[model samples]
Target: MIQVRIKPGVEDRIRGFFPWVYRPEIISYSKQPKKGDLVVVRDYSGRFLGYGYINPSTNISIRIVSFNKEEPIGEELIRKRLKDALDYRKRLSLDSNAYRLVHSEGDFLPGLIVDVYGEYAVVEFTTYGMRSFKDWVVKALVELLKPKGIYERVSDYVATIEGVEDKGGILYGDVPEEVTIWEHDLKFLVLVPRGQKTGFFLDQRRARRLIRNFVKPGDECLDLFCHTGGFALNMKRAGAKKVTAVDLSEEALKVGKKNASLNQMSDVEWLEANAFDFLRKMHAEGRRFDLVVIDPPSFAKNKASVPSALRGYKELFFRGLHVTKPGGYLVVYSCSFHIRREHLLQTLLEASKDVKRQVRIVGESIQDLDHPWMLQTPNTLYLKGIYAEVL
Candidate 1:
């Protein structure tokens, strides 16, 4: 293994359990390192910090997997981490069988994600080093969960960044294109091979269940950027007389409609169009809803995109507020790590000031319990939703 020394004062963060070491933080290396090489990181004084894998080409050059000097990075260690992650999920006792089993850094497995939908598991290896442990990961999951199948879903960007091929599809056993999973007694069709972020947004499981509280019988509801009608069906199931779901992808809308029917939910209007445009049109047409949820996809992928992401949030907040009836509920969410909880709250405050609506925040939601976050890595806490009453 290569010995990597960090610049002075950088070891304190690693000591604090922060897993990432940027390229510029390296002071010296015992040898020229290759991409995805196992390394022992050390402080300036030659004190061992952790064991990690190095990717010389990426800005985030190293992702620490084992912080204890006694523990080394290997198949056994990976299996142990997977077991721990699985144990944590088992303790969560999530209402739904579909959940995030391993949340990358949250599970101390820096570059892997595992989501379970019913009897099947979906995996994504976001880094080259993690992909190298594919056999170990799959074996551990199978032994622990006895999942009927395991599917691999790799992103093109991650593939390019890690210099790995995109081998996205079934990795083990038989995987159906669509699988029905139950959440809070409601059945949803999860498109494992095709849906976004492992079929459904399992992180929003709690928020989807929480939305029912704000809805009243015969209330009109709008679910913007509603992928697969997670919120729309819940609102209808809660007795909303009418619910409108809008999204950019017709495919998602098609699935959303199917989900509505699966739950025996009626009067849900699925609209395939840009949510921003749809919101603007609704506002222009003097449309208003008793409840509205604006759950857009991650707008800021990195720190540099934060400003534009906030602007996008502000626009959606404004439109969502404008179309929300007085005393109605409006929920807005940001899935970007760059967009913090404070950013979403501040944007809502600013939007209320401009829209001239007195808003009272009623609730705030983070990613569901299954997607556990770490204090050392704030980025692990990504999804945030603010539910407010427009007065």
Candidate 2:
């Protein structure tokens, strides 16, 4: 293994079990490091830090897998990690048959994502280093879960940034274009090969169940960025009289329609348009909803874009507030790790002050148990939602 030493004062973070090592933080390498090579990361004084794989070309240079000096990165370690991830999932008795089998850093296997949709599993390798262990990951998934088929999904970031040529296909067995899965009495058609984030937003499984508590029969509801209508379907299932589901992706709305039909509840009004534009249009039209959910894609991909993301959130909240009926529920979610909970709260505060709408927070939710967030690595906790009642 190659020995890589970091600059001074950087070891404290590694000691706290922070997984990533930035490119510029390293002082010297024992030898010339390759793009995806197993490295023994060390302190400036040559003390052991952790064992991880290095991507010399990337900004996040090293992603540590094993913090214990004695436990190195090997086939055994890989198998153990996969087993740990599976065991954690088995413990959760969720109503959903589909869930995230492995959540990248959340599962302590950074750069690897596995989302299970019934008999099939979709695997994504986000980093060059984790890509090297693709065979091991597939074999372990087969041995443990014994899924009928395994499909490889290549993200654009992996293709562009990591430069992996494989355009994603069936790695093992046969994976169909669409797979039907159920979540808490609601059935959905998951586009394993083509759908967003392994067919459905499995991270919002908890939110789907929780939103039922706020919904009432004959209540008008709005689901923004309604990818495959996860929340909209849930809202309808909970007996909402009218539900408006909006999204830019016609493909997503198509599947969402199928999902609504699959559940035998086809009343969800699916609209194709940009969510931001739709929110403003609804406010302009004086259309008020009993419950409004603004669950948009990550506005900020990095820290530098956070300011712009906040401005975007402020506007969304302002419009969302106006569109929400007085004494109705308004839920906002931020999927970006860069956009912290405090940022969402502050934006909500500003939006409320500008709109003069008194609001009280009803509840909060994070990613489901299937998507575990490590305390040491704040980045693992990426999904957050705030449920508020407007007065």
Candidate 3:
């Protein structure tokens, strides 16, 4: 087996059960190995630590597969990890047919994510190590769940960072051009074969349910950054007076309208525009709504950008508050791990003060139970949401 030695004093992180080994922490290696090679990791004192997959091209040089020295990284191990992930979902009993089954390191399976939509599963390989096990993992998933289809949604950065050249597509059974999924009794047509991040943002599943309950009958609702109209459809189903879904992707808007039609929901509007621009325009035009949902993609990918991301959040929320009627509901959410709960709360507070509006928190939520978080790894819990009333 290839040997990887950590620099002096750097073993504490591994000893504490942290999964990643950065390149700067490495002392030496017995041999230069190909990407995704299984290697034995040790401390500077030659003490055995764990086993992990190595990718020299990335700063995250190693991702620990097993801490036990005797444990092997094989088919059985993959089966066990996959089983654990599935069991967690079963326990949660999420009503939505579409949800995240595996959440990378959160599931103890680094660099891999699996989103399930009914009988179809979309897997994303985000590292060289996971990409190497693509076939085995897919086969294991097939043997276990026997889904009707399995597809791949590869991140372009995965190839650049991990030295993984392959961009993902169907690696197994046929994946339909569009897969129908259920969210709160509403039908949504997801373009899995060519859509964003496993075809939907399953992380926001529970939050959407909250929106459904909070939105009263005949209430005008606005879903910003509404990819494929998940929130809009749910609001319409909950008897909203009108639902307008806005997204930059014309393709997504087309599908969003189709999804509304699929569920036999009328009075739903679709707009293709930049969310930030649209919000500013709405504020200037004095457009007000009974309820607004702001679910933006991650603006903070790294620690350095977190402050700016929070500023962006504040601006968005402030604009949202400006356009919402007094006592109206606002559902704000952030998927960036770097944006902590306190930071989000602070941003909302600042936005409220800026708009001179009194805001009361009605509800707060984190990632669903299926996305388990290790005790020490708070970063794994990335989803944070708040339901506030502007008064």
Write one digit per residue (lDDT tens) for candidate 2, span 272-335. Answer: 9998899888888999999999999999999999999999999999999999999999999999
Q: Clashes in each model (backbone N, CA, C under 3 Å)?
A: 0, 0, 0
Error of 1 at 304 (Å): 1.3
Ranking by lDDT: 1, 2, 3
Give the better candidate number (2 or 3) by TM-score.
2
Candidate 1 C-alpha lDDT tens digits along 1-391: 9999999989889999999999999999999999889999999999999999999999999999999999999989999999998888888867988999999999999999999999999999999988888999999998999999999999887888898876688888999999999999799999999988788899999999999999999999999999899999989989999999999988899998888878777899989899999989999999999999999999999999999999998999999899999999999888989999999999999999999999998999999998889999999999999999999
Could you tell me the lDDT of residue 266 within candidate 2? 61
Candidate 2 vs. truth: CA RMSD?
1.1
lDDT value for candidate 3? Answer: 0.87
Candidate 2 residue 82 C-alpha distance from true site, Å? 0.6
How high is each candidate's TM-score?
Answer: 0.98, 0.98, 0.96
Better of 2 and 3 by lDDT: 2
- Deviation in Å, model 1, residue 177 alpha carbon: 0.8
